[model samples]
Target chain A: MTRPGFTGSALDRADPIRQDPAALAAARADAGARLLRMDGIDPVVGPDGLLDWGGLDEAPPGAFLALLGLIGGSPRFVALSGIPGGAQRSPLMMELLDAWPPEEAATYAAARSLIDWHARHPFCARCGAETAPIRGGWARSCPRCRTEHFPRVDPVVIMLAEHRGRVLVGRQASWKPGRYSALAGFVEPGESVEEAVARELHEEAGILATDIRYLASQPWPFPSQLMIACVARTANDALTIDRHELDHAMWVDRAGVEAALAKLPGAPFDPPPAYAIAHSLFRMWLDG
Target chain B: MTRPGFTGSALDRADPIRQDPAALAAARADAGARLLRMDGIDPVVGPDGLLDWGGLDEAPPGAFLALLGLIGGSPRFVALSGIPGGAQRSPLMMELLDAWPPEEAATYAAARSLIDWHARHPFCARCGAETAPIRGGWARSCPRCRTEHFPRVDPVVIMLAEHRGRVLVGRQASWKPGRYSALAGFVEPGESVEEAVARELHEEAGILATDIRYLASQPWPFPSQLMIACVARTANDALTIDRHELDHAMWVDRAGVEAALAKLPGAPFDPPPAYAIAHSLFRMWLDG
Candidate 1:
């Protein structure tokens, strides 16, 4: 029998093209688009037609992105592509960034995360002086102290909980209204993903997770977060929400989620669409 | 009952203080260390005792290297601390690189891996241009392209196979005389760890694995690799070693491994010492 969880199909998926770097580069360069400078415009296409932030006049293009192999969604890459600009101006310019297709979004997400990291980190932490990038921007060396720094991607654990066939969802104050999603938190330095999962569940929903199973992972590039999704079985049903972290939380059964997805008349809440892991989990529960 | 496999303790634990930016900065400042000039050294430290065939300089002074976090056997972080004069030297300067604790060779292994990654990635891969270190040297960015690059750690699958009570292991061509370890290989893009485990076993020893279960993970930083360790139950036990990948292969019953661990004079070969995961796997076989 299949485990009652979503097995992550997004991380490792076979693709013929991504295997050949030269072919991939040729295809990308031929896409009839000016390689946008990451530091110049906020790579994301927002509500506006054009990104307002200053963009670079010219950039030396190279293969700075890690072409992460395709998952079910699409082939992805970590964008190391940058334009001669800083973070402060680019955020505003991102207002002009336009919506991207699925593949482009995935690629953009990876690129944005890498570029954003570069915009922020220009000095060595060890010596508090300027450093130089090395290893194709995978590393940096401190000029003053001779220390090196590498890019950092914080690991965040996200999970869906199934209790008596009802799924648990939490909404943060910063999220869209009635837009409850999976519970998540950063993995600490010494903590395992399992430990992080348990801690996040306990802190956000006051629910203790017992049987935790791996689901899937997504590269969330808003600032380079690896979202690890899991299916967690709840031990205690009693709700004890942490108001400081989550504004509200509840256990919505599969039928209720289906209704929300339908946008049924008079529905008080709605789950995100199929694209999100939360919605995927909800759909899985309904299918079961 | 636990399966016959590796023993992983949250052992070799270092305090979280090492990753603290403030503490690390303070330590470096107190040492009177100055940041090395980025343009001063060649990107690659060649075989000679110099970078780009340059003369050696004294190591950086007052620069203290803090232990970065350990992944499995790899320890990773921003920079290594050393005397200022030692900064420009080549192979001798390698000593200034972070070394793992004597008791924690695995941790040293992680450090080795990360250091190796830094060595390979010094330029912006995207534009093939120079990049700068950022985020306290944990990351790098291309100035022209504005792409950020972070150290990459690849994943590998290492597994021990069991059929009834017999455990399977393989010896690589370069392995020391009489030394044998579990079969392993890089996790190919689009392949799950489980799939990789099965493929590697089949390729190395022609064994088909069933019921593959993840046991533990170690950061093998030999060049930034994460060794996803697992235990698999073999579907059948007929021997067919792939000559190219394996110098030798066999199925050893529990008593044989136990005897090897006990250092019995007659044992053909012993696994890695007690400090290694291989030894732990061997021990688990005995216990089972």
Candidate 2:
């Protein structure tokens, strides 16, 4: 299977040094230290189709800085940034993903999640006290209550529910016309990945899931999400679709899936983009 | 593989009803509405080794209440309760797991997670506004900024790194004497499960991971964590233990693991309790 987009980052997170103030200070002072350049949370891609970087002096004064990682023993830093954007994937992000190396995309993703988490959560949830970066910006500590906060990666389950050699898929009304993808929803607290898959299937399409299996995972930086991909079997073909959540829901056979995946004329629907884990699911399904 | 602890719940989450206020009111008013009885965050076990329950009238007035699920056409509800206890697993919880039906334990785990989240996050992190439960207590909405908050399920990677005939394991200083378990850490934002497994193994034991494979997942509701169990291979047996996080690290062969599992008198170390996902990871490792 192809390595999913926004993965396979080569940077060593160097967590051991994150705890040592002296080490972190030395890293910042190193002549080779590079700071990732960004436009808010968006990546600033270089001519070489990788993340743009500059000396540590380029960081905005007083902005929080987090160690992205180390490459060739040079410290990589990103200034923490956030404006609390809506949970909508943008066309610019798609373009950025296509224009950068997968590893650089992943490195940017890590830095973005950490920085945004710090910016959006200036106060602690436990005691409503102001927070400051700690652990080299991997975590935050509340000064008043001393409550610690870690950057959260919300888990979302995207899956193909199959029955009788057909796969279940759905598309929202607002999406590009003729674009359909596997159904997905956030894995709520207190639910396992399998349970989330089953719950989401049942709630959105009235499909009872069985034999839920983990396929692969991808880190999506639309404000930091971990997409857990899976495939499951459905007991029957019946779907009680929730129209409010989906514009249409269908079970497409392998031939229809192939046509869609190939982007042929008169295809049932357009496949999800290559960067989406759902596309990988369809590819795996085709192979099976 | 055996079902991990805190899974296989039987209740219908009834998400559709969660969105309708009239339906929520109807559920609460139903004569069959059942309130889970709890002594603080701990379970109140019935004589039949199931969760004890009472009528809706037992709920604390004006306390946040969540619809847990529907069981046999009856409404099951849990009052959102929290006192922010330290993250310590009590001995009583172990006894409850040993005594109760697994399904009931799962149900209780779900309720505890939801209720505790509501209690801990009364103030919104986005704007520090006082938040109120919406969507049948499944989500909190900040009145000031209208930013919605869903309960977070922190994903943690627990893995065994094998080299030659032995598997890597570690023990925390505060654990019961001679008790060892898989090295685990929270999956930070912007990393896949595979990345987390590799990062955690390297940080905790200096073992570089390869062929990281997901075994299974378990929802642990001690403040709501999703334990993703995995196994990976290490290239060599060379050891570099970080004493700050782990008191001791070792590579034990199948014989050593078997003896530990059996509670033999001369076991190298005590196996983690049956309720921990680490225990299930070891069991799966042995089967291979």
Candidate 3:
């Protein structure tokens, strides 16, 4: 059983300590407090090709801080809201996961999501007032309206939509040639996981999804998304591509799927990379 | 098998209509367009004791409109952001679920969640710009910053933690007397569902949970929330209640759970209502 990426984090995420301002301040002042340096939502790699770390002293004056729980016995932190979206962040995040250890990669993912949210949400959505970061950068509060804001992890359903024997896969024009992945869309405001699955299937492709089953989930922290992996049976396998969403979509049989999964050349289409939950979804589909 | 409340709706959620302004305008101008009336976040019951609905003519001038998808090919809309949060919304929402049929109830839940989110988000969190509702109230756009906003459905983990032969249950101070349910907490930005369950169980009641499993999900619309249901095995049964969060917590045995679930007199605790995911969680636990 291969574990999905960004799942098993070692941090305790000290929620009680977040509630106590004094305790948080004490943790920041502790001798073992460490900082994860970043470059515009991307983790900065040290000379050793690992996540760059320094003392709390490295955190700039008045810089917004994100407490990444406690790593071992040391309080790990990330300073944010300084370098906001100046680089290509999505690709960099995926690249980071490959370079670091599993727990360290998850820690970095947490830091990136927290920092990105804090950077983007300097003002309140309710009152348009400049909000202050609270709960160790886990939440924000507006001075004018006193409305508290927490970082949002948008839920998305990535489906391996099966019809008869073939499974549906889609390709975006921007992706590398011949590369395709599972159909996915964000879970809407007022929908259950199953409802979102059905809706997205209808919206993205001209198919109706039923018998939706939740397989697994992964934390995708490219600006914070929770990818809920599922398998759904589709009645109409006929591909009516919603061009606004996907460049192309088709029903691929088991041979093509197996070839793509094995990374063989001339396999009709390339599978999603290993770090992606779509890759895991494919594995789950094949295994089941 | 009993289905979770708010899990199914009859609406199409007309994403394509939302993208086409002309089509949406045509729908609004259509003689068949229906408006679901609301009274300060609560649905106004008609003379017949059903959801009060009127024509597009009844939508107040300058009222923010939420397109509650297309109900049986006629666009069902809700006028909102006018009467926002003056009543006891949570209880009213629960009451609405009991009164309406499953599909109608689900539609009401969608309207409530969408309208409430639209009401709260008058401005942008990214740039504090006063945003305009677009996509028929499905999304908002900030003209000043060119940023788009979508209604948020906060994810929460509701867990039934098993230890030995008993399950842990907790109660908040504001809840009705003698009522208890599974421990739940918000899934923070950087956490997975399993991680959230473990963190919440540890934070709310000093317990270590293992074998965490995802069972089901439900849309809980008081404001807006997606409750992810789970059951976990805990090594420790000794309860340590977080006084700041819960009034009390205890490990209740199968006999106690069965009695409470049966609503027997003097059962020691009242179970959560069927509308709540916690109620379903306990039922699943018992069946398993």
Candidate 4:
């Protein structure tokens, strides 16, 4: 099994109900239906430090309710942008990554991504028509053009480049002090994951890589991205960083990575947290 | 490497130039800028059966030109709904999959997907405002909402299930006679790829799977999808077909699959074509 924040859920996405308007309405009225509310991207949490599943009566009007799935014979819905004012909300998504169990974290990730999509897509891109939530908020349908829009999940290639017993890591300009992670970028329209890996490595650090191998995938819901993790073997170690894309990049030996992972006193940089695929990739390389 | 139709292109997207309107206008007049026109979903082909890269001078007015990349120091663009009246056009995307080389075929796939996206998304989904093509057709921006919309690629799980030396294959209700392929479905909003594979297997064929492994992936541009190919081992082989989803599902031994692959006289059913990831999975299982 992958580490937490990757993807694992107990909810059975009863998708057939999504197409049935009457069934969806009935689900909303069902007493067993639980509501997971979101205030913008931040999830509303109860005093117990878990997702506050509130009653449907407490949800605000015009809130978009996305049917997450049937968990234990109860239909669960995630309400976006409809929290009645004065509800306690948690911090941003990254901060709440580990606050819940794996299944609950995955649920929050799904709800957050869906909510983000709904927030961004309110009009029909097909004909400048207003699109209303349909199919239990799993889809948006344009009233004029009749175009149905589903949620989007962008594929990204995040790779760990190993060369001569050292792994290449880069720090983005926006990251905190002394923080570095694997080189990553969005997969372009026409490229394979392998091609994306090679292109990102060369573009970000001026390193040419071969022997690319896919590791695993994690669903990153900082707005619906599928992080396809990979490892590549590089022949050259010299670095030419693109200042526009990265602040700095360098090769770190196993000991250095271990120190960073352990947060030793003299570690050169802080590695990504255990919730990230970057951390998994680093650990895999160090252990292998 | 993965099977053909997965991905192939060495073109540097040079995406930064996409934001520069001056660069885009210059490319439009560069004489070397070749345009691939699409009439709806079909590419305008020349008499010689190649993608007709016509001169920009002949393009129709108000054509949506999607910048593919800088191929060999020249820009390549795909124009949607702008084929000249006299040019010969291919039937549709699926029919022309094998007409071009692997790289060119991959390019056509990308172009077709982008064109489809442009055709469907003409308005902003956020505020019901008209959206204009921006970033060289890679994205659309709403004039009122200031929201940017990018191309979407949906993820699907296509898996081959094997148990006791017999592989499971199913035929969808809509397929032609004697055609059976791998069990496949879209990955739901919250589940991992592993969960998708298992869920699809059980939902479609009443099989419980274990030992799920990712084999390969293909960019299936039948309206923009990323086909994630996998293989799983089943603990029990009892077959219970869901009539709504599949007409029939059965386990085939190695000899049966080999016979079908070879097109033997007494073969029970026909497998998927070589261009499909289903064919690759079957080939891998048989060869291994």
Candidate 5:
């Protein structure tokens, strides 16, 4: 089973072709080359419910074209802040993902993440010098120190903790009123994914997770995160919630999980949808 | 089997305890708190080949302590550019790791990574304002925009690609005359670890890998990298070396891999030592 939001993309990231400045310029001059403009982190969506793609002639002056990839034989590029008019910008949310096909959704997610990275990393971390984009926007190089910096995709562990017949879940204070998800946290500097799973479970919900198993991974690029999903077995049912990290946490049996997974109309507490790894975990646990 | 290097550490990263400045101060003044000072990226290693841990009184004036964790019943902190005279500062290398136990080596790795992160991220990426350390050095917060940034651990896929009784290996131009290792590359913005394995294999060595299996993971904190090791089977054995990325690419039989792994007194080309995931991958492949 595949997690839905951003899995499919047909773009061929022709690394060698993009390296040639002349070739890249030729692609930009081609009428078939599409330009996707971003306003901040959101892509400008036209009234047709899709990203407004236009030719280079229509692009604003001084627009820096960040090559996305080749869609079929034509090149696709994304830019930050150069939408002409008549289009509304929107953040990539669940509803938008649901309305689009997987391939288009994945491409949009990739573009948004790259655009966000470029916006933030304008200066070199090592030398405090202004950096310039290189390798057709795949990397940035500090001219002073010559340090090449690539886009950052932070790894996060999201685990479904099971003890006997129950699954452990927790709700964050910032989450919706009755929504709970599998315990999740970023993998720290010097730790494995399994270790992160155990540490996060214990810290957030006081559950001692063991027998950790890697289930799957998804590109959860809500500003670039790689969600590594796992199934962990916990021995203790008791949870001493760290109130600072979680609002509430508890053990829910298979039936309770199934009820939430059903997504019944007006259900108070809802499990994550098909677009999230949490929903995939619940379905896997229930099937087992 | 546990992978060697940066896997064993008994320190309880008491994150909750770190949130309270008053409690952290109390821990600092408790006399049981031990401080390990780092000069730039290297930790202060004593003549006895161990981190010289001492009380807060031993720390230099105006030294800022980054909390490592509670080792046993005491808090452990690491400072940068704080140690005064006598001790030699060194990077956490394989020779040093060979001298120290796994626990100590891992702790040093963690401390060094955190220290390096703090050194580089003095400015905010979001607002272009100076950032201040928070969460006891686990994170930094921008004063202007209040955006929190955590230490980055980039995920890299290092794989032993096998085709019909031989393993594929390559060496870069910058490497020593005859040092080769498994094909490896960093995981990019939008791909799974498995997909990364396939992509990197094709890109570097012109091998189409299939049936990818997760072997193990190790923390290679030469400024923070998580090496995810895997074993992939390739049906086609043809090699088209990307000269720009690799100096040499070739297939080695089981006997050749065994000879390299043995590190015979004056071997021409040797596999990495036990401290690296590349060595572990070689061992696993050799054993099979």
Candidate 6:
């Protein structure tokens, strides 16, 4: 089973948008600081092996560093978390935007999420006009169309399907080899999270679930998603991966997963990082 | 036992100052258009008891009606849902900003709630300077001190507490006489809805509840609130009204409530209007 809060390296990428309006203002007003559009920057690793946010007044300009939010009463900035010019680069980045206190991660998550949204939705969708950041950068207003735009977050359902003392997980070929995790997918336009969980499992792995119950929720800002976690019972289990979406699908016994977790890379299955909700589901099941 | 969606009028004063760009554009471009600021107009109730949006041809030289969202397929315009100078006169007129359908009311509610927020929060709380609408009306940005303001939705836990076959209901002095319904209260900052339900029950009725289960949720915009519906088991049946918040509290057996539902305004306990969630909660319990 997955463990809660185990962060994976696969999901973290550096976002390139200047999210902190306050910092943007500071940078803009400072005679020594330079202002550059996101497109003008090149993809290159700095001396630190991380996407650089440039140096102090005396240092060289690296990746553009912009302050985003404050976590635990301290300023937090987004880093280019991925390798520069790497083939597997994902545009989205997941950083611990908040300070290390951790108990109040939800607050930092909310702040980081809105900042990320601002970076992406810079124009009015209805009129396709350039929008200006207003309301302290929490929203944007278009001069041409006057349309106001807010950040958007999609909801996805992640569930642990349990029966016969075992929980089910599936693997996508895109993930690291032998890494299997809970069944998850986005909630559709007209469906509830509960319905989405059942539908996703049915479509991806041919599993029918019943007695669904909600457990917890996590703010997953990998391009703005809210993961609704749930627990369900499997009425039937058969292997069927929609080859178009997944490379393989199966029902692994809890003991089998335990063995895999113990064996590391040698096993045919590994759970997602502990920070993910999937890890939490697996941990809850194993603890029980 | 508390029913589904019943409580007196929700707190309805909002603090947004931003306008929807698209709606503003449509208003400006309409053939018979005029625009008037909230401070410039004197609202009048017609003989028919409805505030009229003067026809396109008759609209004063620069007058345009403000529209919010779509109802059904047509745009729903804001023309005053209440009368001027009435005892229940709205402190603020509800603006029709978009044509949001009822099926997507939750999403529409979010949009409406935030847009309405911008309409109200025009000044920085920290510094009294005028703020501009930002992030498409999701927030307000202060130019003087650079502060961002976000829309706030108060979370309330509405619960159905069951004791054997009977359900609990309560009445508030401000409500219509004989109008009794579910128990609910606002969830404070830093508290979960589950904890809110448990605390509200104990405070208002002197009862303890266990077995809390989430049932459903609704977006109520009397002034932007997210109502979380839940079911709980009563640990004790003693009745005590915390008059600080409610007028009366009591436990009515299922049969009595069923009988009361059939005769509104006649019995000591009255069911809420059919459109309310409280009525649905009562129905669910009765059917169960």
Global lDDT of each candidate: 0.54, 0.85, 0.83, 0.78, 0.77, 0.53
Ranking by DockQ: 3, 2, 4, 5, 1, 6
The candidate that wins on DockQ is 3
Reference-based lDDT, residue A151, model 5: 90
Candidate 6 chain A lDDT trough over 10 residues, lowest sum: A8-17
Per-candidate DockQ values are 0.06, 0.74, 0.77, 0.54, 0.53, 0.04
- lDDT (10s digit) by residue, model 1, range A1-288: 222111233333222344455656653453331333343425534345321122222434553544444345343444454443234434343323223223444444444554665655666533446666554344566776677665555556688887888778788888777787778876533234565677678767778898777654445554555555678899987888877778988888766777787888755466764444556555555665
Off by over 4 Å in 6: A1-108, A260-268, B1-213, B217-263, B266-288
User: Which residue segments of model 4 deviate by more than 4 Å?
Assistant: A1-6, A21-26, A37-40, A62-64, A82-93, B37-40, B46-49, B62-64, B82-95
Chain A TM-score compared with the true chain A, each model in order: 0.70, 0.95, 0.94, 0.92, 0.90, 0.67
CA lDDT of B63 in candidate 1? 31
Cα distance off (Å), candidate 2, residue A1: 1.2
Which model, 3 or 5, shows the larger DockQ?
3
Candidate 4: give the clashing pairs.
A122-B125, A122-B126, A123-B125, A123-B126, A125-B122, A125-B123
RMSD of each: 12.0, 1.6, 1.8, 3.5, 3.8, 14.4
Share of native C-alpha contacts between chains A and B (below 8 angstroms) recovered by candidate 6: 0.00
Winning candidate number (lDDT):
2
Kindly report which residue stretches of model 3 are placed more than 4 angstroms away from their true locations once superposed.
A85-87, A90-93, B85-87, B90-93
Q: What lDDT, from 0 to 1, does candidate 4 have?
A: 0.78
For model 3, residues A71-166, the per-residue Cα lDDT tens digits are 788888888757674245466667767656666677777887888788788899988999988888889999998889888888888999999888
lDDT of 1 by residue, B159-215 (tens): 889998888877878877888777777654323456567767776677788988765
Local error of candidate 1 at residue B187 (angstroms): 1.7
Candidate 6 docking: what grade? incorrect
Question: Candidate 3, clashing residue pairs?
Answer: none
Candidate that scores best on TM-score: 2
Candidate 6 lDDT, tens digit per residue, B1-288? Answer: 332221211111111111446554554355554211222122233344323334434434432233433333333233221112112213333222112223333333333344444444445544446766543234557787675655545445788899988888888889887888899976432233455577688878889988877775545554455565678998999877777778988888877888877774446577775535666677777877
TM-score of chain A of 5: 0.90
